[model samples]
Target: MGTRVSIAVVSVAVTAVALAGCAGEVSDVERAQAKVSASEDAVAEAQDAFDAASDEFCQAGESYIEALDRYGDVLNETAPTVGDVRTAGADLVEPRDDALDSAQAAVDTQADLVSAEQELADARAELAAAEAGPTGTPAPVDTAMPSASPLAPAATVDRVDQAESEFDAALSAVTDDTPLSDASELFNSAAVELEMAWLRLFADAGCLADEQQQQAEAAVRAYTTALQQELTTAGYYTGAVDGIYGPLTVEAVESLQEAQELPVTGTVDKATAEALQAELIALGGVAAQDAVASTAAVQQTLKLTGFWDGPVDGVWTPELTEAVAAFQVELGVEPTGTVDAATIAAFEQAISELQQATPTPSPSSSDG
Candidate 1:
């Protein structure tokens, strides 16, 4: 009876051990399967995230390209007047800034996609290891896919930067108190730089070459029109504000030259431009109305008679008054600085005497 009881206890112990071993094997399999399932879910989630990131990257790339194209258009716009230049320049600021922002966003989105793809690969590798009982190496992670749009070339980027700078300078030139000619020169120079940039882009995208060239030509014409408009405002140009420098425009230029005592070249030279600007400023006030003609005449007479040493620009300054007083005292007239009929008669008589006393030299005999 004792031997039977001991055998029975040993049998129970063996049965219990077998049951525990089966449960342990089952739990191991379940744990491995759960790990694989979780890894797959993680990989799927990562893939979804990567896909979303790629979409965002592509969208941002498109936005940047659009902004760049708009900026190019602004640079190529025809700004015929100061107002036109100002408006076009103002329009450029927003797109220029947006392009910069979108470029950075695209780069950032690409980075996020790369990271998400890496996470997915890691999860897949984990899943493989889990399934294979951690014995073999997992597959290699794939490289990140290429982006929809290639990165802008360094030269292209540089050109955009230069264009922005030049555009800003051109805007400032017109908005400030810069002279008309100086502003026009600045605009022309900025346009030239912008055209160079556009040409570089056209080299890559030949389809846009003709349009860009036409736009550039238009811009040049606009600058010419601006010059004509400025000259017209100065009362030196009576011709149409057409961009062409025709005979009428040349005649107006000659008129300006004669007024400013410059060489009568009938051309819009730098000196002519400066003179026109000065005349415009002078014409802005009553000084242009010939209202001070009497004062100017007195000053001219005083200067010719060696009494006044001031400009005869029609300003009733204190020096001019003093000069008048001196002339009156010398002529034994009332010392009042004001001019009247008596003063004018005295000045005319003095001028007549001086002219008669001056000996007329015989003209040199011409050689036969």
Candidate 2:
């Protein structure tokens, strides 16, 4: 498996690598190197995980096979007193079969991943080699270019705030009777994101001397802590939250993300963080029926307007609200948070009319 690093490259170019262990400074070269290092580490860890998962998957499979052999022995040793007893005994075999199937599937998945990561490591190494050649695009001479992100400061501030909030929540979640394995991992990731954001800010602020090293250290910490928090939040808690992106956290985040139906880059993103936060909140608060219903409705509305997927639990979110406002903008309706009678009536009519016109899976929310 080839490793793909989805790191956001610094548009601002730096001719050389930033010094290590500085508080809040970084160059593009350092950023690139850090990213490559992360990818390499991830591929290595994924290989280890594949090995571990294979062990468990194989062991579980063997256990099931042994159970089947034992069952066969028992069947040969004793005739069932009745047909129902034999049927019940046969039913016991189903769980064993299911276990074996699941284990083998897991083994297959891990085998594929190991291959993919090795391929990626090769591709990246080759790219680095190519970049070294004379024909390669010349490294930019400037490191002072500004970031091109439209939402730079605001986004950074938002990220830092989220990091702090998630940290506090994760702390509480882990300490609570019901440990929040998911939120803990994300909080750590957010912490890393904050560190990354801070370094970017320092670079943008023209911190050239020692801030460079500080920023590099911060980026490492940001990525590492995020990985750690994710691991803890998954049922795979390893160690203390030391704000270091080590091997254990990387493996844990990848596994958790895999379980959560997320991209397995092992890097925590916005959606993953949000889902983790939601999970922690759920652990704290009793999920109300109305909340689930509202979430479903939001999902329905987003899908209707081509923003959301199928599930619509009624929990209102900023995205859902913004989406609803956008829908209202399109429909010439008031952009209120509540889905009032007017909005529903309009949606109902629109969905009915659309479905009536096109008998595809484009049926309205009302139909559901």
Candidate 3:
């Protein structure tokens, strides 16, 4: 009886050990199966994301293509105006950028989908090995997958750049047949482009090692100053010939534009410049313009010396002539009512002497 009881206990112990081992093996296989399910879900989610991104990319690409077509239409128009071309080019910038951004997103999501598919494949292989026991060879995973390639961003960039170049060329192609307002529009467009290009190239710190920025700005400023000078000669601008494009300059430009039957945008454009040149030509060209500016300077100088109280307009009257003659006499120069190089030299010398003779006042002592 004792031997039989011992045998039964040993048998029960062996059965329990076998069951436990079986449970552990089943758990491993179940866990691998669970991993495969999770990987499949991940792949599904990545695929959905890729689909959405692809749709967005397609829409953006279509819109960009339409924008390009519109731009082409504007360029191909017979007798197209400057304003029309400029507006079309401006409109193309946004859609082109949108398409590029969408294409990049689509490429990135495609890469994600590819990666997720690889993970799923690996998980399935692992699950198969787990089900087949320790001696079974795992199925091969597809590791040699193609990488996600970029779609149209590079070609789009090149095409857009070419379009912008062509647009700029079209804007600058001026001829005698171009209308006055259209010519002004071209100038306005070119000036805006130059300003934007300058900001992009030189507005940041350390963009250039030297004074190129200042020189570039000064070049534009020189043009403004010359414009003001011409407007002064035309009896439009009465303000100082400073390079600043102030409200006075705008007002003068508008007045000139209105008189010439051009658009009154208050900007110093090519038409306004031509009108100013015509006015100068009517007044006897560069020589007359210089004389007017010099006369205005002489009038200011006479007012400073208390020899004249007339308005410092560039117009010459008997009052200005008498003032010049008196000033020449005071400076021991010939009493010429007309201003020449000698009169200008004599006035400059007199002013220098006057400045030197002026006394500097000392500060007063404080009482304790």
The candidate that wins on lDDT is 3
Per-residue error (Å), model 3, residue 362:
99
- Each candidate's number of clashing pairs is 0, 39, 0
Best by TM-score: 3
List candidate 2 stretches off by more than 4 Å: 1-29, 84-88, 94-98, 111-119, 122-368
The residue-level lDDT of candidate 2 at 217 comes to: 36
What are the runs in model 1 whose C-alpha is more than 4 Å off?
1-79, 139-150, 175-368
Model 1 agreement with the true structure over 1-368: per-residue lDDT tens digits: 22233334334544554576675654433443443444344445544554554445334433433443333334334435555556655565565455456555544544544444454444455545555565666556454542434344566656657665755665675654545443343344344444334333323322222443333333333434555666667766685553433334455666778978987655443455456556655776643453344345445556545565667664556666667667766654555664422333233223212332222332111110
Worst 10 residues of 1 by lDDT: 359-368
Report how far residue 182 has shifted in candidate 1, in Å.
6.5
Which whole-number lDDT from 0 to 100 does residue 212 have in model 1? 35
Count residue pairs with overlapping backbones in model 3.
0
- Better candidate by lDDT, 1 or 3: 3
User: Which of 1 and 2 is ahead in lDDT?
Assistant: 1
lDDT: worst 10-residue window of model 2: 5-14
Which scores greater on TM-score, model 1 or model 3?
3
Q: Candidate 2 residues 1-368, lDDT tens each?
A: 22232121211111223434265676444555554555455556555655565555434434443343333233222232234224434544565455445544544545545544554454455446445565566443332322222212565445435544543453344332432234333433433333333333333323322433343334333434443554455455476564433234545656666777887655444444455445545555332222243244345445634544434544445565566666655544556543332333234223312321222332223322
